[model samples]
Target chain A: MTDHRPDAGQPVTAVGEVRAGGSPDGGRLDYGGPWRRVSRKYVGVVVAESIVTGVVLAGISLFFALVIGAWFGWWMLGASVLVTVVLLVVAPRRARAIGFQLRDDDLLFRQGIMFFRIVAVPYGRMQLIDINRGPLARVLGLSDLKFVTAAASTGVSIPGLPAAEADKLRDRLVALAESRRSGL
Target chain B: MSEAGGGGAQRPVAPAAVRRAVEQLTDGKWHRLHWASPLLKGGIAFIAILAFVLANLRERLVELVIGQTGGPAGPGGGGRGGGGGGDAGRTFNGDPISAIYETGFTGVAILIVIGVLLLAVALFAVAWRMHSFRIGADAVEVRSGVVFRHNRQARLDRIQGIHITRPLFARLFGAARIELNVAGQDAKVELSYLGSRQVDELRRELLRRASGVQRAEAAAAVVAATTRSSAPLSAAGTSAGVVGAAPAATTSSPAEQSREAGILNRRVQELLGPELDLDAAPPESVVKISPLRLIGSLVVSEFTLVLLLVVAALFFSTFVLHRYFILFLLLPSVLGSLGYYVRRFSKAARYSIAATSDGVRVGFGLLSTSNDTLPPGRIHAIEVTQPILWRPMGWWMIRINRAGHASGRGGSSAPHTLLLPVGRLADVEKVLALLLPGLAGADTQGLVMEGLVARGRAASGFSRAPRRAQWLRPFSWGRTGLARTDDAVLLRTGFFWRRLTVLPLARLQSVRVSQGPVRRMLDIAELHFNTIAGPVRAELGVIDRRAAVAVFTEVSAAAVEALRADGSHRWAS
Candidate 1:
């Protein structure tokens, strides 16, 4: 966990040692808490979605190839299979890459494996905090949290949190947002 | 201070008197727009159609002109008289009025014309009556739409700015249109065809109410307004930056008072009316862009450079390479785009920026002029840039991000984001002082100048992108850097277009750090300071990952602190 921190052991880091807080949502939002990753079940949901997409794509290719020739069908079938395999292999790590931390003034979210992105959205600047659950994620008891600011480019989303944790996070964020609401 | 100078006789209306005058207009009852509302509303299309019909009827005018030469001698004489001999069938088969008689429909046509005129007049009268508005305490409500009614009320607190535009037709009628620029997309409430005289007072009254000025503050604001207005006007004719001469305005004697008023009136006239009807500005404007400079700058601008390259290519292929057909195809479009930009720039030919009591007033246009008053603290970000050719000329363009722009690429309408089209570096500094008063600190002012003009490796104090990042921006890596003041963060970027963006900390919504596989390998990251959407993209492309993390932390904390301290929303309070 210490290795995950950038500039580790450096005093420039305002992010202090992670510790647990004894509250409903406070534990996850604790200033001292370790950065929280989305639920592991999210990997299953992602794999399920990838399978649906892969099957649809291959189905279309198979239809075209059957109408035309087996040669075209073989090429498209091979490509679709390759894509599905890559997505299936990468789903778990991609799910693992997503994490968030609550600081003194803001909530920091980080994601991506190949292209890393981290955003710090001050509580006061938050215009909207939404919780959405996909059909597969719902069945897996996982949810996604999203934040909107005045800037459209600040499209920050934390995907695949446990359903219960998501509600806790929502309540905590809404409270913090209300107390510090400032400029739009 | 005004009282101490015995300047009360010349002092403009005081707060109580001014409020009393405003109260007459804001009586909280529905008031109809100007009498010419319907004509201004529907008359534009009507006039266009009339012009089209007259153009198609040019044959009749020619016939009348040549009719005297053995043609019809009298108004009613013509028709099968087979007049004008050979030319009879071609055009003046006689007068059009006489043709109506020959066709046996003169009485019917006359009746129809009278009937249509009556109906139009009746309709306009009703619309003028129905289209009414009410100015209440907390909100301004407008009601209209005749058969299908619409009632919209904009809250006083939400009024972002006030815009008054005088179209050529409206100006001919001595009327102006006012748009209440509310703080949302398509949220503008428009009141059109108000008497030009009424518009100034109405705009001031609305802005005053929107400012949330209380009775006490209103009095003090009047004095401050006088002081500020005098400073800019006096600064115009004297050595610049006489910003702190507020006290001097109070100590003037009766003799000096009259002289100042004369200069004030003369300066105002010069601002409003310049010798070249197209370009108007105070004589001492640091960069008074004349029509010649405007065209000259366009010739050297990047757009023209691209155009010249394409034309040269066409010439080469047509003459040397013998590809003649290609030239014919590309030449027209190249010429068309050149014409388009020329027209676009000229529509805003008469550009001027001045300090008004309500806010900074930016005016633009040629035949039809428009003015917008941007209230203080509404500007989210400021961007100053110089295209490569403009650098040596010391010409720069300034743009700012506000809550929302009511117009989309409004060509003849106001160019919404454009603060200064073209001006000298000194003009940019003066405009910045007016727009962002918090930059008054000498340290921040110095930082801004360094960001604006310092190019090449100058050893400026900004945190420069490292040498390793040269691969990312081969030519511009040396020029890109980030600096911060207590109130804002400045990110300077680009090579040919040398750009600087200032994002006030209070307006920041979020901070972001991004790194791709290549950037991660190089141990560098890009930092983004998310502000309200506008032309200025505030981002630091590649910096040390550790520095990115540190600055990200600092900005987040500082932005929150700035938000807590911000009181500019209700500036009057």
Candidate 2:
């Protein structure tokens, strides 16, 4: 696979002629790309998961067909196809919406389309920020940045970001939140 | 309302002495809740064994019945085979009565004797365990346990409030169970086992003690006030110059006199609920119901049901009603009458605003009694609630909101006192004056009230969503958006029906951020604000994740500052 990122060159169309956001001026970028155009590092993992899930399901169906009957096997195959299609359609859109902007005093997140909402996470209350990349996300070249607070364990997550971006966000948020909490 | 502590070392502290304290424990007489743990396990075990025995012997039992009845069975069948009712005997053979008697009449008699003996013993133990209570001047002690004893002690100072309830049976016995809400404790101390005479005696003693404490505190406060005035006068002369003493004394005396007059005015004002019209009692026609007529109608209406029931029963039975039947119906009627008597409208049920050392003690109770000892310095915020029905009556319930020792909903329940249950607008203002001492000086009443009204109206605009969450519309209307302003966070949305709740950053407990599949699908995040006490839970309804997080960070810092300020007060004192 070829890497599209050219550190020294001009901004290019990311993937499939889809401009996630921003003009030639790089004014205010909006909308993330389809997760297929996901970071190259995670592509292998996603393909491996897909192949493993498909093979296991197919093996189970074939065994049942031989032991029981053909009707059950066909039904199992149909159900698996329907579920796979649904997940494939939803995953990219979910990945695309997950992004965060780190500001000096607070963190900003723009999410949702219909009832559009923006959350401002201030530094003082930002207890911790953790970066994690799962198997599917790794294949997609994506990672999640989580913001934890002292009030509860269920923290906020921003998904579909590049791994390096996630790490940088975590470092900055932790420092700012710590300084604010310490009254510095 | 008043409780006296017996401080003397020689005072007898025994189980009987703690009777008053136990009565104050809860709203009902203390009966040991049957130690059901052991009994429940025993019952389950007994049922299981019985089921197992029957299941295992099912085939054998059928064969035995067939043989006994001589129903075409083999060699064991000795009785008549062709008898018409022979099959009935097969089923009846397993009956417990026959099984015991088959051994001999002695076995059956022994079973009955054992049953009666166990019942008699159980009844005695129950009575013995429940009748015990200990009372003392400072605290009431209760020791109750059947096999293993547990003791509960309640202090007078920890008594937040009292509630007296007379269930039907207790009413006939002329008994009332006193329930005391102990501060910083889950176990409510109750004194239920007292008879009418004992309850009356205990109640009298508690009231006398409470009043004595108040009187002593009042006297001390008066001396303090006199001494404080002299010291201030001297201090002003020395600090500001002797020439300025005359002006200082003149201003101080008038201010003090006006304050004293205000207290007297408020005490009188409480006699008329919040909505009193000083101009005149609304024209007689407008008053709706006259006091005399209301009283007369209530009295005449009483006991009509009982009288009618008795007459109807006599007519139906042709005066041949069983003697026991009459006695049975009389018990409930008599008990109901006693409850009605105790709960009847009385002058004593009216409101009273007693002068206290720090502020004023306003006490009231219909059946559930409450006494609020509000010190102005400790007051946090004031709220006025107008129930839709009270609009016609022109009454508003004023509440004082404060922090610290807010017991009830675990650690989260905030402390609040309902100062005016039914009072006019002016009365609400007067309460506000005492609760928020600097309100008049700052002239912020109009601004604060207007701000609250505006906020209340704006709350209706908050978004509340539809029921079904579809795959297409990942973000439900239930989500609320918040904007972080400089001083406060602006929240707008109504979940379904409209209501608004606002909290200052200083009062926020913590901030929460959450993301789910639907949130990710819609490219939205959520931020939640947790408060110590309020109707809405902070996180669930929040829609604007980014704004919420920003607000969270800011409020977290502010909350820390407020806590520090609260801590500093201890040092200042």
Candidate 3:
């Protein structure tokens, strides 16, 4: 088997290298450990959502075809089929792009494909760290971790982490937040 | 400080002192306001109604004059009422000229007018008597009611500010209303219809006591009393004794003794007395906004842009509708915007920001002047904005979020929050220096300018969005960046209206890094620095993913270090 070390061969950008201990080395910064992706079953969740959307679109199209004419129905069916195919192809890729990194003082969340976004929420600034489980997520044993800060604009919700991992992160964040909040 | 102490000591102890103090502090013995207060409160409404009645009578009175001049003596006609009989034969609008002889209508109208005047006078008298306020050692209580009594007390330490407002009519009478804004309280403790001079003295005294100096002295007195006497005095007794003794101690000076008598003598002629020049002693001027710039800012503002659109619509309507009726429809809105601009700009005209020993003082206004003194260490956050249009002129507006009592509503219209309405970039630096004196260092000015106008990747230690990310924000991608100093995090964004947000590390409540689907494809992120609800909201958009992570970690760590170094949270204190 090939040797596997998470930190051994990660790409380092000119901006900074991600170090574990959060110490500044020269002009470099510590961007915490390697990002941990959400559960693989999150792909199943995305596929289910896309399927439901496709079914809804098809049903609307079938109604239009039956009530109006067969030609309109055929047009809507083609459109719905095209949309479903796109979702089927794109859902897994989209799910893979979402990842989060827990640092010494803050949590860094990165997501999206074309319009990439990375959000960092400091532990000290967290007013609330909530865990939410939807019906599908509950069935799949996955949950979302939400971070609420004092600022209205800076809230973050990280979806599709395993239930166990979500709980552990919630507890860790709460403990860190408590210790750091005394200064504020 | 010595003058305050001297003035306090020489205050009279008998009629003026004991009576005024007791009336200001206790509910047992209340005092009525100046007798003219009734007329002052409701006189205008009474006069208006009376004028309406008189106007209605004008036509009938005129006809009576003409009838007496031309008609012959007739039945129901007495001395000064008789006129030529032939003239009385004429009719006005088919009504007989005898309609003017209707005494019943005239008598009833006169009686109704008199009755309305009496009711207005009585209502004012009742309102004047119902409202009374008492000043306690540590709190001011205002009690007012006719049938249902309402009482409110504001603690001296909790008092944030004292605003003296003189409406046009009040200014005519040299009367001003004192509104005491209390921290965390929605309602203000108002003392209305006080003589302008009394209002000034009362405001000064309240502010002085609120500053905690007098409270410390009172505590010392309590300690002395506790040690000297075996029997414990009641809470009210201790407070009353301290209140009476502290003023006496401060007012004992010989020079103040003469001034005390002069104040008492003037109190008798309060209404007719010269207006108390309400202006505060001007602080040393740092910057004065010129009228030309003030008007120019207003003309180029977004409000004026809307006005221009309306004018264009009006012009366009002339060709389409073939009439200028649209002008009638849009005239009010155009006039309204013009009036609003005039009022806002004219009030801000002669705006002068000054540096006081403790903080910055801002004074502005033409008709109703406002002088606001904001002590250092109380500001929550500061924002320096350069609108896209104002960018060419190199002008910036600096606004601050203060710690105590959020202004009643949103928007920059909130009084006292605006540090500079419009000023050059250099003026922004001066105001920021006064506001956050601790944050300035050798290269701060350069860093500040870079934060304001710098472009491209890594300009002045800023990590800008990569070129690949430019597709999403084509105009602003190069300009948007994040930079850090030892004490502050600067976030710059916007292409046309470039905004620079400076957040001191210690004041930061939280930091957030967020990414979306489009950003994920480009490997970019956004960094948001959360502060308490304040004017300065710091957010850097389209930062590279790696740099965003670095920013998140560094800013969080730096904030902790800054807080530790500062020891005390400025906002909390």
Candidate 4:
């Protein structure tokens, strides 16, 4: 209120001078942002999926009416269209809210649009952690982290991390897990 | 530049080489080839797609038909003109117009279309999602995601063997498929589209990595064991640094570090075999059956099936062809041949054998490669098994007792080990070098004789206690108080092959005591060694309850003491 902007007589601070990011002493921090966004890239898959769904339902609706004369088919077709439209509109925002947290000891993730879910994987249990960037994911400057453990038949997956961050996390996680397993 | 100078300059590039090697090893383009079998996979996809298209078309047709027919105009009358108009004017419920609307066929048609369509979409999505894979450091990870994405990651350590093959077309395309037989994991990891050179490099890197880790761990364990055993002599003069989690000893020393690496590699190799018949008659012995003998055995063993097939073919002729009764005989032979081929294929495989300071590594397998590394110190006990067949062949199989065995059962089937199958006395000595280094120079024949003597003692009247236990013996005719053991009962049943079993009290999960009326009356007792091997338990029976109790108590106490010592050592090391 009293001269918010620094004058020549007072000490002036640059915008960049303020500690902006997080724990600037270089300690690990959980940096999260909205992950799911309907970009031009993912739209193709979404549209294809929706159309496939619509067509299949329409066929079933006709067949039942023609043969057994069931009433559920028409409802199913209408529901499919409604669901596809809702998902297409709402999915991006939901995905954006979902993200992961990293700590020295564990990698944690929280996802799901309607029903929230949180999964925490201890470093010691991680058999392997890889950061993969597919052709599309690479172009979009995003990466997915795959956390594999020996406990499950198939390894666990954590998607939608920044590519650079994902790689750093992968290396640190592997080193920590292996070291902990050896009781080091 | 001098060679040394050139090499010095390349030292900085060494890490890059390692990264490149990792990249090369993990670049498994072969998984794409799995889609080639799309006959089954692709057929399902095609069906799903067809259903989708058909459903769409059906819905449109039904909607159009219903819209035209269900109109308020006289049913069929206005739409088709003259004849149809007259039919539409004819009776419809009570009124011609309302009857057509009341039938509900229009609504039913719409329902059927939607139902089929949803199912088709779900099926397609599931199939597409399931066809995913990832390349990893140790093995390939493949998973399918839909409703529940099936995920499986194989350990390169347990890969027992590998097979590199190319179909006619694959060969022309300069790509080969690699099939790995990994143990522990049920499913195999197939890499289908790798180049020949890549396959070679991949195989070598995996092998090298596995062996390197195995050798290192074995060496460290051996050193530790040796130090533990020998340091007792100098315990008073100097602290062995093995007490109370000493800071220096607890932190992994240079030697221990190397040994740990070796063990890891060995573990990777063992994880590679998938077709490993855990139930197969021991892996140490490689049985060779000549092709002629193999065929002869097949014919002789399956004589009944063959005869049935022949009779059916002769009498039924066209009926047999239509019914496929001949397939029964053919199927067995084909399966048997395949099994035989698998075994034979394994025999020809070469595995790098290493003896480290800690343990011994026996790596073998092609399609399902595996490396088993056993640290001598970790072995609680050793048992030599002689199957009825092996008895005639003068072959013995040695198995070790250990903890945390995946085998849920106890005893012979308790997931112990198969050390040797058909080794001579000298081979046994060679193996004992790593298994029981302290006894490397000990007499193998003498030990065998000692085992035979022990068996005899059990089967005969070696030690007779009080007269109360005579009836407890299997067929004891002698009138004695404390009866002799089973070794005395089976003295006359000696054969060429002797089975010597050593049960370490430390690995014993429990000691179970059972007694019948005769046993109670004669004061006889039976003690069972409960281990992790499922179903097949090891039991030692005797005619004297007192003797049994003493042995049981002593073994149990010893095991507990050893375990406590091991725990402390683990903490200290």
Best by TM-score: 1
- Judged by DockQ relative to the true structure, which candidate is superior, 3 or 4? 3
Window of ten residues with lowest summed lDDT in model 3 chain B = B1-10
- lDDT by residue (B1-573, candidate 2, tens digit) is 212222111244443444444345332333332122123214446568768756645644666576667765332222332222223234336654334434446455777769986895686556455534454554556776666776788654334444344333344334445554443334456655344333433543443232223233345553343343333122222211211232233344323332333322322232233243221111111011233433433344425466567657755554565556655656577556656634433311434442222233454444433334433233333445554434444454555433333335531112225455445555554444343331112233333333324433232323322323224334324433343332233344432222222334433434444555565444344556543332334443534333333444566455555433331111111
Docking quality tier of candidate 2?
A: incorrect
For residues B228-327, what per-residue lDDT tens digits would candidate 3 score against the true structure?
A: 3212112222222232233333343322322332211222223133243112333335677789998888777777777788888888887777678878
Model 2, B463: alpha-carbon shift in Å? 17
Question: What tens digits encode model 2's per-residue C-alpha lDDT throughout A131-174?
Answer: 88887777666787777643332335666557775676567666
The residue pairs in collision within model 1 are A18-A32, A19-A32
Q: After the best TM-score superposition of candidate 2, give how far the Cα of residue B408 lies from its true spot, in angstroms.
A: 12
Lowest lDDT 10-residue stretch of candidate 1 chain B: B1-10
Candidate closer to the true structure by DockQ (higher is better), 2 or 4: 2
Each candidate's DockQ score against the native complex?
0.32, 0.08, 0.21, 0.01
Clashes of 4: 100
- The lDDT of each candidate is 0.68, 0.42, 0.60, 0.42
| TM-score per model over all chains | 0.79, 0.36, 0.61, 0.36
Interface CA RMSD of each prediction in angstroms: 7.6, 9.1, 6.6, 24.1
Candidate 4 is graded, for docking, as: incorrect
